[model samples]
Target chain A: MGSYNWNWPILLKEPYFGWIVSGFGKTILIAVFAWAIAFPLGSAIGIARTADNRALRLAGTVYVDIFRNIPLLVQMFLWYFVVPELLPADWGRWVKRDMPYPQFITAVACLGLYTASRVGEQVRSGIEAIPRGQRDAGLAMGLTPTQVYRYVLIPVAYRTIIPPLTSDFLGVFKNSSLALTIGVLELTSQARQIEEYTFAAFEAFTVATVLYCLVTGLVIVIMRIVESRTRIAGTIAVGAQ
Target chain B: MFGSFDFGILLANAPFLWNGMLLTLQLTALAVTGGLLLGVVLAVLRLSPIKPLAWVVEAYVNFLRSMPLILVIFWFYTLVPKLIGRPVSGFYSVLIAFVMFEAAYYSEIIRAGISSVRRGQISAAMALGLTKMQSMRYVILPQAVRNMVPVLLTQSIVMLQDTSLVYVVGLRDFLTSADIVASRDNRPTELYMFVAIVFLVICFSASRLANQLRRRYSL
Candidate 1:
């Protein structure tokens, strides 16, 4: 076996350092953009899952099942490689050739869509976890079903589910690394690129690992603050024994 | 709208995809087994009276949990071969990565499962003159495992979906097999759609089963 060299300085050097920064930026971009799509869409689907109409609930369930069951990597490939081809010819050409940051767009769409299924489940459970009496009380008070959800259900559900939503938010950041598979140049792929260029796999991955931990750690800390701040004051704490 | 798709391509590549599916199952089984075995150890250590041991285990789980699995896979794919002074096969490398990475998750689950058991059970076991190990083995673990069954099943489903990342190391898991055939036949849409359907069926059914088990066990 050849002797392995430990080179730490390479990561701090010019192009590689720039790559890491840009890659980190892209990772944040993907997560934030994906959340922008996932939050409202997921809340809507979650609401639909509990809707009185059978068709609406079924549609929501179907959406969640299809999106959640398939692996995100496969979805990434389909969105990037297959979706364009299925469109009209000119549209296909435009998506394939002329769309700006096509890979980034595809990655955001895939991650957003996939995460929505999970968030929708969380939202549905949050809504379901409310006492049955609350809904009945809302209806008795002359509120429409939609108004009941908007006024009595969604607000409480969203607050109660903040902890789980925090995890999902972190998941979006972690899953955004898959964007690299579609050529999105996210942090993980940039690590792979650095390894390819320098053959210092250990150094490259070490830096990447540190950066990931830092981001996730920061997210956790911030979320803890959010959890405390947004916590309902009067209700019994969830998961209290 | 999907009139242009040729289902024949999927039919022709059925055997290849089946083999890929088998590999996916094989990897998932190995990783889950290894992960759980190691996870049990880690969880036990984490909850042990030894503070340093617990701290080390806690750090290991936390740091690993915070990172992208693809990076971990890449790390082990390179690191394992160097550490062993031999070129490890991609399958073994990936297996190592997955077992290590998944152990963190499973340990958390196992830790929760263990904690979910009432403290009275352990005290009662000791009062019955059972050794600590015997109490853990015969009393606590049995109860914990029962509570953990549903969650373990759900994690297994996630692991199955995660097996697709083996494509990074050029292992021909189910999705990768579809990718190969898609590129070869120039039928990306058909093959990927087929891939999605297969995963959908397996995962959806398994998740439903898990939910049923969860409901049953909760009662």
Candidate 2:
């Protein structure tokens, strides 16, 4: 009992206070960066998988298979600690020296790449869900294949994938905690710091839990709205009963 | 620099890596098995006639689903030991966390599978003079389980990949062991590439098996 003391005042004071706020900022930054990178890359990979070109499909499949199978933490550590060292000496030096946010870069890159595999699958399904006649109609209207995809395929696919994409966004948000291992000061890292500084593990983690729930809750609400709005007509009516 | 990535190092460390691999598989097996059992129970609870029971299960699922796995792992590691006033091994701690975290997800999957079962199947089973429990046991469960194989396999692959996260808790799983070897030898790219390949092989096989099952069971 003596070991557990309630110290709300200490938690709110200098250093601890700044650390938590910055940690929250970093977590949001990591999630946003990861999502931004993942979406385009994943969409490209997804498009590539269904492309008529064999090589593109092969490359896309391999990339998705490899990235999706491995764990995020392992990939992050590899990128952060291993990849730079394997580079040519001068290049490695530049990377090691010039990169101020090595951990952050690694976190974002790993999370993005990992998430891209999932989003790629979602995008592929979304595109496939679109009727082939739509693409034919685009072609019939004198649009090139590229134009057809950009103008017709992509817009429809993006809209269709919104629900899955939202879940992926949440996944990236949760996975950002892996960044803490590489020493990026995210929410979980800040909690660890607070616990170390004040020995208030329970309170620090409780705060983190609340913050996580709040962010995830917000994402869920937004996704539900997007899902309902974008839902195909009569699907729910038919689904419900 | 590590002398052009010596295969000899990996060969020498093969035994250690094998141990870690065994632990990783064991962890995934235990977690998935425990999770599925707990998940089925929660799924049943979610579908129970009692409103309060269903509400409790829903809350549990939502809370677990929303929380990060790392935080859950950490919380369980700390709370379990403190509450019991005895040290739980890191291995069991991770297993417990995985089961708890995964059960929520599995419950949803199971529920979906159950719901997808046609309504008339139950009525027809009742028409055969079977009790409601007997109908579910003899008819609904088999059909749901059959249709659920592919999805469950996918979830199993996810659990396999997620086992790597246990490294954070200092468990000597494959990823942690690879990290140790890579850090010690300074050959991060080669070692991590190897680890990635191992995971790819495992997941690829699981997915292939899932596909085969899907084709076999296709209506």
Candidate 3:
């Protein structure tokens, strides 16, 4: 029988603490950068899907469907392996050899683009839920279609979808762990490394599990605040996904 | 760059990929069925009037939902054999992990579906001398399941995508098959492209079907 030599202080000590804390930092960094890209990219695609032109709508739909349906892990590998090779030879060489932190770049891009598809879906649905008359009124008031969306459609849609958006934000945070599959040294990977080093498989993951719950729990609280503060009066009933 | 795109290599590996695809589909089916049933129970318990029990359910869902799927996969891959006193296969470990992990997401969908049913309907069922469980079974659940099917299926798409994670435990699902072939043949681009397309086609069609079902069933 194996002896149960549990040391809670292992997490408080040198290499383990640094590994986990930095891993947490990386997870947040990847999620934040990804969301930064996803938000604008998604809004553009969302607007495109809601456009009157068929080609634009179709383009948006195709982008969302292709990216959303493909698994993130597959897409991650595609970005890491295939996308580089498909670039021009010199550029491909740079990505493969010379570029700094290519894995991180690929992880961020894959997660950002993948998440944009989902955010676009939510954005489109949120915009569609707005009354058609609002668009008409903005047009009647001498607003361009773009201006109408920018001024009239977007603000309300964003407010309405805050709850769903919160969940998606949480989704991105969780998904960032997938980056470790491509050698990003994010939280999950660091936990695995710790387990390998200390031979305390359970302890390493226990710390990680607690850290995840804490971060997610904090995000929920902050998002709840945002949801309430920005909520339109009597419009969006609070809901869970 | 794509001008010289090679289908010949990918076509030659179709049978190899198919084996993995089948495993992926099998994992999805098993996980979805087990998860959905378990999720329904969790949802009911979450919504039950028993405060302590509801809190316990809430904690379970919250804790699991917060953690990443890969972490859960790792935990189960190592932890299960310890609990059972015998080593289990990668396939069994992954299946059990996926079902438990997916149940959290499915529970929320089911809970939302249940709450979407009008309160008046439940009251009316009770007025007709139906017990709470009986009313939920005969009246509420039928409607909830109908409304929830589309969302459930949408989550199934996510699960199907997630089955690729079983590759980490060396369970040779679709992505892993493509991976094995790619590493062996040094045709990573072609094989990955092929696998990605297969995933895209299946998930896209399934999503369309879900939308159709949503329109047909949603009240």
Candidate 4:
């Protein structure tokens, strides 16, 4: 494992150190925004999936299938290039011309949509796992269907699904690195940049890899704490995957 | 732009794209087979009684899983040649990276499959005079594999989509070939769209097969 000079000190020097830290921050920012987008959108679609209306169910399924099937890179490119061009002329011009943080927005949207599909699956299975009587009891208590979902079904489902959702959260964090391909200059791209500049490929990547593990490990620990606290007694078997 | 769409660029470059797709399939096959072999070995070690060996394997798996696949490809691409004291092709470098990274995931799948085989089955086999390794080989893995077929297929689909990431290593995978044509003909839209369509079609079919497997296995 040690053929080259292992200069661990290089990462602490002025430019490389700042570059890596900023990249780490960007990566975290992307993950947070992506989760912000995925969670609510996924929850809505997940609710639609369990709805009695046939059209809503089909719409949810189609959204999941289309977004889930395409490779994330392709989706990123599509959002950045094809989608903007597909808009009306003035709007397209605005996207390609005057839009602020175009790459950032596109990457966030692509990641959010892509990750929403996976989260939606978790949500669907979670809602389905609740006892049928829960829905009936909510309705029997003079609540509307939406209120039943909001008050009874969704809350329970979300609690039971914390663990799986945690994995999905970690997954989105990892996938955000793919934003580098679209020229987002996130953590992985920063590693490549450092490698190109200093030829310290091993050191640069090792540092970045450690940073990634640190972030993900922290997420796992936090999620486990949340999971332990929210765990419902005797109802743990619901969507346990 | 819609009225001026031109797939002539894609049509002429069809053979090149086909070659790229073949290369992708070749890579996927090699990685899945090689990774599964390595996965079986790792899974066995993980299931073993030795704590330190299991810990080492766990760390390796968890670390790789935590990092992005693209980073792993880059890491191996830059470091492997240095370690081996010679130059290597992009294909070999990417292949090694894929095999190593996918092995972590496959080992997890295999380990879960192995664990699903009941404790009694292993104990019963031991009582019948089979060694631990022999019992796992003869009695446990066979049933575990049957239960695990669907998940393996699902993971393979994921691997297939991930093959496109090899483009970063300068490997002309399905997406890369399209990018080449797009640049050559000055038609990014048509060519990239074509690549996306091809990916969608292939991935959708594979996902359908996986869904079928899920239904069958759940039954």
In every candidate, what fraction of the native interface contacts is reproduced? 0.90, 0.62, 0.87, 0.63
What tens-digit string does per-residue lDDT give for candidate 2 at B112-217? 8898799999999999999988999999988888777788888989988888888767899998898899889876777787888788788888888988987887
Superposition error at A91 for model 1 (Å):
3.0
User: Model 4 over residues B81-175: C-alpha lDDT tens digits?
Assistant: 88788998889989999999999999998888877889899889999999977997899878788777788888887898898899887799888
Instruction: Go through the candidates in order and give each one's C-alpha lDDT.
Output: 0.90, 0.85, 0.90, 0.87
Question: Highest DockQ, which number?
Answer: 3
Q: Give the distance in Å from residue B25's predicted Cα in candidate 4 to where it truly belongs.
A: 1.1
Show where candidate 1 strays beyond 4 Å: A235-241, B120-139
Candidate 2 lDDT over A141-177, as tens digits, reads 9999899999999877777677678878889998999
Residue B212 CA displacement from its true place in model 1, Å = 1.5
Better of 1 and 3 by DockQ: 3
iRMS value of model 4?
1.4
Local error of candidate 3 at residue A190 (angstroms):
0.4
Local error of candidate 1 at residue B120 (angstroms) = 4.3
Write the candidate numbers in order of decreasing lDDT: 1, 3, 4, 2
Candidate 4 regions with alpha-carbon error over 4 angstroms: A1-3, A140-142, A236-241, B120-139
Looking at model 4, give its docking quality level: medium
* Per-residue lDDT over A1-241 for candidate 4, one digit per residue giving the tens place of the 0 to 100 score: 5567777788899799999998888899899999999999998888888999999999999998888878888888788878877788999999999999889888888899888998899899999988899999989999999899888998789998887888888888888888888789889999999989887888899988999999889988887777777777875443332
